[model samples]
Target: MRMYISPRAPKEVLDYAQAEANDSGRHANHAEGSCFPLSWNLPPGADLGEYEWVLNGFDTKDLPSINLVPVRRDEPWETIDAHLNRFGAEYLLGIMPTLWQLEVRFHAALRRSGIPVMMVPPINLASVPSLFAQFPIHTVLTPLRYLPELRTLLPSRDPHYMTILGPSDAPIECSPGGKVSQEVHLVPGMVALFQCETLAARPTTGFHPSDRFIWEWENDRLYVTDPAARFTRLMLPRHYTMREETCDCGRTLTLTEAV
Candidate 1:
């Protein structure tokens, strides 16, 4: 069986999902296939069955609208180039680990608009500088732990932007000539969305929650309830502490530490 989880309180998430479902003209129920109504909620400990599929965030209906290009780390440059040229790709998106393994010539080909997706511990800290020097990446997604190192590596005069991966209580140091923002990575067991774009307008040094999701702190852990999430509640897999102070960005988004 396939289950579709929708937020109960935030009407916008449900409304958006329903709109997409309606636009696609798919009418599958909770017990049926992938298409499900916004009113459906997953009961506590609901039996998802042995091989059930759960759809959330972007549903099957949203697939047609998204243009995704898949590239393998081992794929030859000629093959990747063919796909890029065939699709008329404007930019390349890849994980930091994969980008580092790719040939330098490949980096040069897509350096114009390549955006590297980074994660904590997954990305090799030592190779970052070489990647930056070889590929002129203007945008990056990384975690708070690497911010200081990244700040030191970035060119003083170049414009850069970053989207932080998770919560942190440590002060967010500014980049020499770049902007920093925050975002919650929707992992397998959890989903979260923060105001990443709004925070980009100014520099901030603490963690904050966006109005788009409900934030809860309990037992030294942070729980996020995203209105657009497929799961009811997602507990972040880290210890956290909430601080009720107004940030320099003029918003009381609160501060939290992810340890």
Candidate 2:
């Protein structure tokens, strides 16, 4: 059968996957790398019915062990909440579909309720009461776009827990007292690596290449312009933005509320 690879797929993504696949003993949740960083497309001109593409580098032979907890689609909140409570997930990681939805659906209520409010991180996963009882979750990580929003939206006048950028193990420095200063700094090596090694690994997918990964920066502070940045297979650019700042508690990155 004929096969074609996506031209957008970065060489480093393939290299990273190959390295992980070859050395299966590495932890699956590495801070510096990701398991699935890009969306590789089948080459054009191949007979759709006659050709098939087999993705390499995902052979889970030596990857870390993880629980694939399945939840019922009909009543996911009930099902997942029970599981998390049973398993004791103190720190929960979640995905926000978009900043607009986050603001429209829950931000106001959340703010009114105050910081440290019991929540399931991604609001859809569980009811507020269930989250408080099942997990010790204090921090909710959103997409890179939401980073600026979170800095402004969440009642984080003080340095709370941790702020992880992209898939790296390094955490960004946040100010104390929750009043996030607009000042920022940038890291050259990480940014270059992300552009060449990570973001380079995927096609624009279904979106226009120009609109593929939305980003913005002012005074070296980063901002996520598009909300879709949360749900894409692209590399998270939070660190890329963080690496360009001077780390001053001065100016803030401009945030445009999604319409």
Candidate 3:
């Protein structure tokens, strides 16, 4: 079995994984060293398809784990409220297909401290202002297509937006006008176990590439290579123009603009 360490993981954890890989005669890749390998080949009879991605935090089995309460679209609001109140939910993470259709009462039913984290697709941009006024949504995860409208609609709420390529993938961009960041997972999967993150204060339209992965631009296309990940040289679908100069915010991380 191949194990990749998260960039945020403690030094001891990374060292242990490296030591184990070395002892087992498997090649180990780390962010501190040279660029990752470009090969995408797998060993004969080795199948990674059966392995499910899991995030293993520092805690052991004895510690209390996170409880995720799933709510169906057609489920009664009373039942949802009961579950939230029973679990003493601190936040609401919802996937809404239509933002305008969501009742304001649903948000009002939550406790005062229960911030909402909403994930929505490209919806009618006109409803954005009213939605924000009615719901105290702390964070929004949406597709790239809606960013231009969101930027205009929520200029003051710059730090609350994240751009996602798909439901399973990690966010491509986070907090547009505030601190821009992205996570590079060690293994390419819906859930990330080992990953590294890149952060910059007040980035323009792009982010700096983390040392955990190597990034290349080919004809306006962005391709990333994660040494510890199973997939090699994944290309981003978006076309971007690169800028090497310092940003107005004084951050020196290389910036890119979606073109």
Candidate 4:
């Protein structure tokens, strides 16, 4: 029988599995919190029993509306051309760690062939113009951590392609060039923030939250605070500043590790 193990699986089951795995030296490989980035947890010939551990979705219904699908390997260029032409895509958005090794090279080749390429970092947006000998992207959307690197890469002109900084669900501020803002807003309620803080699901077993953190940014430093709630052990960078701020969006709480 196939058993689905969500992050919300029974404590006993999770504990038992963890204990057994620890004793057996069979812990999941590349495991990130409740999820595994890859499926290489088991040995070459080991069986994982009938139980299927699903860290995210049970199936397609739980996935996002944005399609981040793989391209046909035999004719990837043709595939990209077809998709962009058919869908009328302005410029292709390339999320890194592509499905195939050749995907990145093909994308670079396409850029050389004069197609626009908007790469999400740590693919290095700084090298876009230098590598491709073309104009910089119209806009760059990156996590706050990468803003420092971006500052060194901004073109001389003011408002040289907008830069969006923040987490996925948070309300990102668009800077004209490379000026980092002091504070940013969340979408009021979103799963990305809850997941980041390792906030558990409500009684109904849903990950949605009515509360979220407002991030304060400065000098390439990030501090997040959500006073109404406390954080779990899984949050990154550990202890926080715990400052408070009043805003039209919502209450602001600060979190970050000691410098």
If both were scored by TM-score, which would come out higher, candidate 2 or candidate 4? 4
For candidate 1, lDDT tens digit of each residue in 1-259? 2122223356665555456546757432222222222333444665544122222222234443222222222223332343345445443333333322223334544553352332323356666656656655544444445656666665462423334343222345443333555544332111143333333444443345544455555565554554535433444554545555565546655544444
TM-score of each: 0.38, 0.22, 0.34, 0.29
Model 3, position 48, has a per-residue lDDT of: 55
Q: How far is candidate 3 from the true structure (C-alpha RMSD, Å)?
A: 14.3
Error of 1 at 209 (Å): 1.7
Off by over 4 Å in 1: 1-138, 142-182, 188-205
> Against the hidden true structure, what lDDT does model 3 obtain?
0.39
Better of 1 and 3 by TM-score: 1
What ordering of candidates by lDDT runs from best to worst?
1, 3, 4, 2
Off by over 4 Å in 4: 1-117, 120-127, 130-138, 143-149, 157-178, 181-235, 256-259
Candidate 3 vs candidate 4, lDDT winner: 3
- Stretches of model 2 off by over 4 angstroms after superposition: 1-90, 98-130, 144-173, 176-259
Span of ten consecutive residues with least summed lDDT in model 3: 187-196
Per-residue lDDT tens digits for candidate 4, residues 42-138, read: 2345444522222221123323422232212222233234334533534443433222133354454356446665565455565644532354333
Displacement of the residue 111 alpha carbon in candidate 2, Å = 31
Q: Which candidate is the best by TM-score?
A: 1
- Compared with the true structure, what per-residue lDDT tens digits does model 2 show for residues 147-228? 5544454342322222222232233333333311111111100121121111112221001011122333333222221122
User: Any idea what lDDT model 4 has?
Assistant: 0.31
Best lDDT goes to which candidate? 1
- Where is model 3 more than 4 Å wrong at Cα? 1-136, 144-159, 166-204, 245-251
lDDT of each: 0.41, 0.29, 0.39, 0.31
